[model samples]
Target: MSGWLAIAGLGPGDEALITPEVTEALAKATDVVGYIPYVARVAERPGLTLHASDNRVEIDRSRHALEMAEAGRRVVVVSSGDPGVFAMAAAIFEAVEVGPAAWRALDIRVLPGITAMLAAAARAGAPLGHDFCAINLSDNLKPWDLIERRLRLAAEADFAMAFYNPRSKSRPEGFAKALDTLRQACGDARPVIFARAVTTPEEEIRVVPLTEARPEMADMRTMVIVGSSRTRIITRDGGPIVYTPRSVPA
Candidate 1:
């Protein structure tokens, strides 16, 4: 078939941050599918169908996109931030792995975009400049105990951390536990950044010490970055810059 499927990242929020590659894929798409908000980002036009689904039905969404593509429709699955980073690309692959063998032969491509952590880091002056790890704080797919264990271990490693899905209405306590774990392991002096709605009109960046950070500061829209023990803060006329130095002692 002349059909193809492309999983594309729409970047954090700003239209300017969207890569040209993803933009071109959208322009050529016969069907655009994704979570409601991300799918809504695609402008409605003639001959382009938009399939916006709920947040939880990732496998169903992936399958719908694949079916459309196999039927000679050029389909694009749009994701906020990078698709590979805790997003739709992996879900699509999971569906492919379990589905009919024909899916393995379908033309598929992953078009990367600027993820939230990178956008958030740029706004806060490179808090992730050194060794860092990105963790999804929501334990929807995993156990809470495992999440807590990972948090403690990350702190012990002294790696800068960028967290996604820090808090949600259903699981408010997870982020609070994360804060407690960080405070105990990383101490109270390290910088903790709460970057909300990065690159959008509603964007807000706040850098506070671990002692001052409250779990309530973050929501589903926020990306939190906790500095390593060596991370520094530079106070300037404009605002404070948080960054990790590139070199370490031998």
Candidate 2:
């Protein structure tokens, strides 16, 4: 069939960070499907249809993209940040796995882009330079207990961490609890970096000690990183630079 589906990441917020591959996919797409804001990023072009949907409807959106592809339409499924990282790529695969057998043979590709964690890390000067883990604190797909357990374990293992969807209107208490758990497990002085709206006009980056970190510091637009024991902050005339050294004590 001439139809194919491409799940492409638009990167964090900057148009410059969007990869050429993703741009080409969009240019070739007859249909572009994604969250409302992400779909809005694609310029209006002749012969291109934009399907913007609500958040939390990933399965339905994936199915729509697949259906459009099956009809011989070149479709691009857009996502912010890397599609494979807590984004549409997994949803697409999950739909395919449980979907029709024919879908398994469809031409599908996942084009990676700069994820929010990486973008946040770079803006903060490489707090994730060492071995690190990424965690989604939303608890929308998983249980709160599981999130807490993972946070404790990550701290015990001394792994630097990047967190996504840290706080939302409905889940404000979750991040507060997470901060408390991290403080109890990781100690009082570990640095926590809150990077909001990275690469966008309203971009703001803040670093605070774990003890001083408050739940209100994060919002849906924020990406949070909690440093390992070795994460360091260097204060310069411009600002502070955070980084984790490559070597550790023997």
Task: In angstroms, give how far residue 62 of model 2 lies from its true place.
Answer: 0.7
Question: Candidate 2 regions off by >4 Å?
Answer: none
Query: Could you report the Cα RMSD, in angstroms, for every candidate shown?
Result: 0.8, 0.8
- State each model's CA lDDT, in order: 0.94, 0.95
Number of clashing residue pairs, candidate 2: 0
lDDT of 2: 0.95
| Candidate 2 per-residue lDDT over residues 1-250, each given as its tens digit | 5899999999999999999999999999999999999999999989999999998899999999999998899999999999999999999999999999988889999999999999999999999889999999988899999999999999999999999999999979999999989989987599999999999999999999998999999999999999999999999987799999997889
Note the residue pairs that clash in candidate 2: none
